[model samples]
Target: MPTLIRPFGALLLLLLLCPLAFAQPLPGVIASLAERAPWSDPLEALGTLSADESVTLSATVTKTVAEINFADGEQVERGRLLIRLEDGEEQALLRAAEALSAERANVLGRVSQLQDRNLAARADVEDRQAQLDQARAQAQAQQARLANYRIRAPFSGRVGFREVSVGTLVTPGTALVTLDKLDVMKLDFSVPEVFLGRLSPGLALSATSVAFPDEVFSGEIATLGTRIDPVTRNIEVRALIDNPGLRLRPGLLMEVIVQQRLRDTVVVPEAALEPSGDRHYVMVVHEEGDDHRLEQRSVMIGERRHGEVEVLEGLDEGELVVVHGLQLARDGLAVRLLGVMDDHTGVREILEAHR
Candidate 1:
């Protein structure tokens, strides 16, 4: 029993003498410090691209379409005839009315001359003038009726695909076509009220369409809605883009990039951010006497650019941040600095790999 106790005591003494290593302080890569420098202005929400103007063409009266002057999907100019109905009777009436108007004018002129010669009542000249005016108004009405038989373009734009054809009956309420003016385009998007202060009119913006993945359309903030939507707690924003070639169409799905929102921020690689629960963090490296060490710090992040994040707070300029192996890190742990993560070898490199 004494011999057994001696061996057990000896083993316990050896264990007590051993100076255990505390898990090598969790390995991580050090990211070299970037002086708190001015970063690009950040953007928060997206926008869409729409037509600058969408005009709905409508008829003024009920009539059977005699001829569709413009073909489907036609580009029309202002005042150009787009459709025509049977107008023989209306045209004839207009001509007769014009003749009557000319006769009334002649009578008025004769009455005026007689008044000058003291051969006519002042009332008679006035009556003749009124008759002439009525005749002219009748002629104008007939002219408008004739014009109604033809549908004319109100503005220069591209006509949407038509659902009507020759001989099809239509009315004043029927939608003929949609004429969209896309020389300059518009974008309508929404943002939370929290970003209300960040949004400013005339800020530069860019958008990309899924249909054309390779293209990016640039634009500017045109206007903002006066009220917020109660259901979404969001406010609507409008952006105007120049579609010089008329390539973009209405109802296009897009991804928008609004610029120049944030004044100054520090941009860092996304890998350096360590998120836990509701907060985010980044490990900072420091020296202790003769040993290198790590310290965990909370960070306030702002906008994200590609694979980098904007550090809003909890970090100073010219501080080393940990970018890799943060899952095994702790506060004030002794660390060995092999090398530092850099623009070429750190988060920037990770983002390029994904891209």
Candidate 2:
């Protein structure tokens, strides 16, 4: 009886020790502290670029081009002479008018002196004055005609390729070249009429171009259309972007994003969310004495951006949430905290470094 009792006690002791020896260790997970960050709803649209100021230069009269003062793609100043046409006839007429005007002035002065000495009649003095006035009028007319032979830049800007060269005959309204002010660019885009209430001058926006995939351009709204299109139900918006480097050109297509409705809210990593049907859940690390346990909590999420989610409810600032090894996380389960992730570091980097 003593041998049987000893064997049974030993078997019972082995059974209890086996369960403890085979117990699994706590699961490891990476967590991040929930923090408040600035959040905004973004509105996206496509935009077309244009120069702040643009025009095509043309000739005002029919004449042969005598001199081309600007080269293709040349920077010119306002009122700079760009083209000179053959003006020999106009110049000759102006010279003749000037000579006649001088002769008339001499006659008028002589007649006035004679009238003061009682040697000439008053009618003679009046006739001389009228002749001088007529001659001066003719000279002024000739000068006005001569100005049509020259073409000058209307504004300071870059000139496009020349369409005509020296000795080429050009008629009135013939296009000579294109001039554009490229120091600033104008971006035009349309937004739905529903956003008209939110649209205003001085609103901030960002733009990107396929031609420059790595570059982002910043700008602000300059104007909003007064009326919305009845057919399209959209309104036009214009933005101004500085182009100090002259990298942007007219007619380039760009993608634009407008920042709207900004607020500061509690946020967490998107990876920490576990979707259960229509509800989202997160494993929050709760401290109990010296041990850390996970508490499964449902969260109300709002806007999502850049791998981060805005937590509208069921979360608080400075609370730790699991971001990695989520499969091992469970309510009331003990977890080994591997590390904490920051705004810049990734979970894979933290895990590799921990190992």
Candidate 3:
């Protein structure tokens, strides 16, 4: 063969043997990735907002309201006067009883002097003493009834709707008002009764309310209902959160996330896996027949976080798992070698800068 022909043949052989080694590379596109991390048990649910401290206010006496010291939905201090009633008649009775008791005391003293001189019968002295005791008892009773006319707040809280107005005749058993202390709010949620044993007071949780979508509130496992709701088959639980501004109101809907347990399962980006009915699967690149090929792998998913999923099996650490472009990849499909895509750098930078 001629020298030029021989050189051309040698180059052709090199091309056939190393197709990937010598071709002008296609544009280096960013390859997607699925990074594995330690999986943790995630708990999530929806709930309703409630005040950690809530109570009702009611009238304690039967009388016509003389004065209303508070307006509806106002904050009140503990022991602050809230309502006043007619007390002039009761006050007069108390005063008259006191004068009569004073007169009875003087009579008892005279009777004691007569008895000491043996001029009065013992029975007579006893009768006068009994009369003085009855007068004093009547005076004490009148004072108690009069004191009840003035109603005061039992605690510092935000009052609810007013059932009656000034000059409204109210009785002892009337529904007066409601008080809600919202400084520290509570969230009432429910979980399947099967998890009842796992719940306890003081468990930490994170919650959100529609009123403040941007903020996350901290709370704790405050209480759990003793009996499950038979119709719902769910166990009611409550969490307490500090709300200094009283922005959280009772009966408002909320979302709650609780840390149920700790786990060490494999975690991957949610994009890496595809759901197939009950089972989940992902694509992984592996060496097959002297060439790199994509293989379909079935993985058992446990929990989810953002765009991530927990892989209970079928994945290992340090192994590359396609993230974004996996839907386009097929089993045994040849993929041109590109660099692994890393989206975590931005997250790390943000956290580092914050620190």
Candidate 4:
């Protein structure tokens, strides 16, 4: 029994000694000191680009299309004639009404002259004047009916592809074309109710799209939804972006970020975080008497932007945290400083690798 116990003790001692033998200062491990800086938390959300004003042009009355005055995809001014329907019959009727109105006016003039000469009854002159007024009203009504055959642009915008051509019969409410005011773009996005205080009219924001990865569009908040959506607990936000170059289009998907007021906070590289289950930790290096040692510290993280993260708790300014070679880090183990993480490009390269 004593011989067996001695062998087991030796085996246990060897297992313990093996870890000590392998323990050494981890080389090439990048480390950086945390610093307090102005941090502006950005809210990320998906957004959609829309036209400041958009509509599908349609006819208000059934008529045969006689002429198309504007070309497809043309930029038109307000009140420009776009479609002209068959108004020949209406024009003829208007001409007849005008002729009748002219005859009534002549009769009214003669009646008034006769009344002045004491050769007509006052009642006769009054009756003639009434007839003249009715004739003029009838002519005006006919002229208005003739104007209905022409469809004009309601606002200044770029026209879309027309669905109808000349001589096509269109019914009331038939879509003729689409018109969009493209000088300014409207971006619609939503944010959680928790961010309500941060959202307001005139707030600035930046947006990006997959189509234009290098370009960042800027805009200002134009409006906000009156109430929060019960299902999502989010409020809708609308922003207006100027499209001077006509680069942005309606319905484009965009990633939007709204900048908030800045506050002083501790910031660190994202690579330094070691996520374990629901908790997060970072390998921290501390000076103990004559030796520098590694320690694992749990931290409460806040917002993340670019390649950096805001540490809300468990860290202070000027404390070094391991950023690279974290696998080699162990609590209470001695470690060597490879270099400051900021001195080398490793942190940036690591952050951009997945991007």
Candidate 5:
């Protein structure tokens, strides 16, 4: 009976030690130490994209469209003829003016010759010269009137769909088509008046559109408003973006980011942050002798970029933060440090690989 009790006691001891065996330190958790670095404060705002120049092509005179020189949505250079209107009457008037001017010029020359020969009075020569000048003025006016019948592009740009076809009669201000210089884009956005001190021309900016989520466009501030809007207390700002690819169009909405200033601050990998409701926290590794443990730390975060975040407070430089295996981290729980992540690889790639 004593032998049987000894065996039972040994079995009880083995069952009690099993829990301790299973509680050994967790191995290979990705981590990195916090470090101080330059952090740029970014101001974000929404902006609208516009062309460098845009206008609606229209005829100045009411007349039938004699010829359409451009197809719908054609790219044209400056002074390229787009439309020609019927100019029969205007052309006839111009011819008549030219003929009258030539006749007056001849009479003036004859009168001058007669005056030289002492056959005509000086008053008569002066009157003939005045008549010639009047005729020339009328001819110039007629020429200008005839020019209105032809419409040409004022600048190099892409034309929109044609509103009037050949033989279509159009009047002044009639809708013809839109023309826009799309090689360069203008971005207009408003920022709060408080940022006025930091605002200036030539500041670098970056923009992103919802249509192209993965792409970013770079530009610079081109203009600033003189007066702030009283109602919103915001000032308007314009930026010029080069669109050599011709991807951005007028009226496209974009998110604008302006880097205002930079300062040295504590930062950590983005994966170290653990969100709880509206609060953020991180797991800090504590080293004591041969044992490594975790300490739950609440961190105040600031600017974020790429795969890193700025730690405003609650963390010190050189403190190791768990960048992976957050679900297994607990306060005072033993863990094994696999290695330190010193590179700039994004958090998503790390997580994807680990998972």
Candidate 6:
């Protein structure tokens, strides 16, 4: 009986050691080093473009159009004569006023000479002076009235299509053309009230238009609405963009992206994140001699942009995180370092290159 018991004890010891001898080898995984990078979560909204200055030109008096100096859609300077009405009558009246003014000056000069020589009464000299002043005032009035017959540009801008042709009789307030200063464009958009705290004048923004698909227009916040819209819970924002090329026009729809504040933070590939319920975790790989050991760490994450996740806590720059073969990773699990991933390379590329 003693010999049988010894043999059974030896067999039990062999069974216990067999499991350890046949254990599976550690798994292999791809990892990436966490690094610091500038990051910002941009805010997006739709906006409309408008000229820096805009106006509609119209006739201020009833007159027949004698000459239209500007062509349709012409660029004009300030005070440039744009149209001339039938001014023959005004010209004749101005000539007559000038002649009368000349005659009054000549009579006043003779009367002043006579008064100095005591050949004329002092009252006569004073009366002649008053008549000369009145004649000059009348001439000045006629000159002003003559100016009303010509239409001139109010400011430097691009003019729209002409609404009336020469010989067309225009009444007061008759529409003539539209003018806009297009050197700078004003972009207006709305943002939710929740983002109001983040917005301020001079904040940079970029805009894109379907009309110019390949071009990106840049600008900054110029002003903010004084009051928020209670019904929509939004606030209006205006940005000024330099439109040197005059490509942007009024009433153009564009997509706007407001550049938020940038921050430097540790980031890792999104593939390395292990989400469970509302919590997130990453398997951090620690180098142990020639082998690597993974420690499942809970990390506080902030923003996720592109394929990278911003690690707010529990991660540091220069640390390695498992990105591929995460399904085989766990706390305290041993892993083989297959390869490293980088910002410019994908996981599949790294894995295939290692193979």
Winner by TM-score:
2
Q: For model 2, name the residue pairs that clash.
A: none
TM-score per prediction, in order, is: 0.66, 0.83, 0.65, 0.66, 0.71, 0.75
Task: List the lowest-lDDT window of 10 residues for candidate 4.
Answer: 346-355
Candidate 3: which stretches are off by over 4 Å? 1-45, 53-56, 60-62, 101-133, 263-301, 311-355
| CA lDDT of every candidate | 0.80, 0.93, 0.77, 0.87, 0.89, 0.91
Clashing residue pairs, candidate 5?
none
RMSD of every candidate to native, in Å, equals 9.0, 3.8, 6.6, 9.6, 5.6, 6.2
| Candidate 1: tens digits of C-alpha lDDT, residues 149-237 | 88888888999888788888888878887888889888899888887887889888888888789988888888989999999999999
Q: How does model 4 score by TM-score?
A: 0.66
Model 2 lDDT per residue over 1-355, tens place: 9989999999889989798777888889999999998887889999999999999989889999999898888889999999999999999999999999999999999999999999999999999999999999999999999989988898999999999989999998999999999999999999999998887899889999999999999999999999899999999999999886788999999999988777899999999999999999999999888789999999999988889999999999999999998987889999888889996887888888877
- Compared with the true structure, what per-residue lDDT tens digits does model 4 show for residues 1-355? 9989999999899988798776654454668889898888787899999998999988777889999988888999999998898888989999999999999999989999999999999999999989989999999999888878888888998998999988899888899989999999999999999999987888778899998999898898899999999999999999998887677889999999887765899999988999999989998888788667888999999988888999999999999999877887888878766567564566666556534
Worst 10 residues of 1 by lDDT: 21-30
Error of 2 at 295 (Å): 2.7
lDDT ranking, high to low = 2, 6, 5, 4, 1, 3
Error of 3 at 206 (Å): 3.4
Per-residue lDDT of 1-355 in model 3, one digit per residue for the tens? Answer: 5979999999999989999896663221123445555554546789988776677766777788888888888999888888788778888899999999999999999999999999999998999999999999999998888878877787788888878787888887887778888888878889988777667788778888778999988988888988888999998898888886778888988888876764566666676777779888887766466455677889887878887787778888656666645656776676543445466543334334434
Least lDDT summed over 10 consecutive residues: which range in candidate 2?
A: 17-26
What lDDT would candidate 4 get against the real structure? Answer: 0.87
For model 1, the stretches where C-alpha displacement exceeds 4 angstroms are 1-49, 260-304, 307-355
Q: Flag regions of model 5 displaced more than 4 Å.
A: 1-39, 262-268, 271-302, 310-355
Off by over 4 Å in 4: 1-39, 262-304, 307-355
Candidate achieving the largest lDDT: 2
What is the lDDT for 353 in model 5? 69
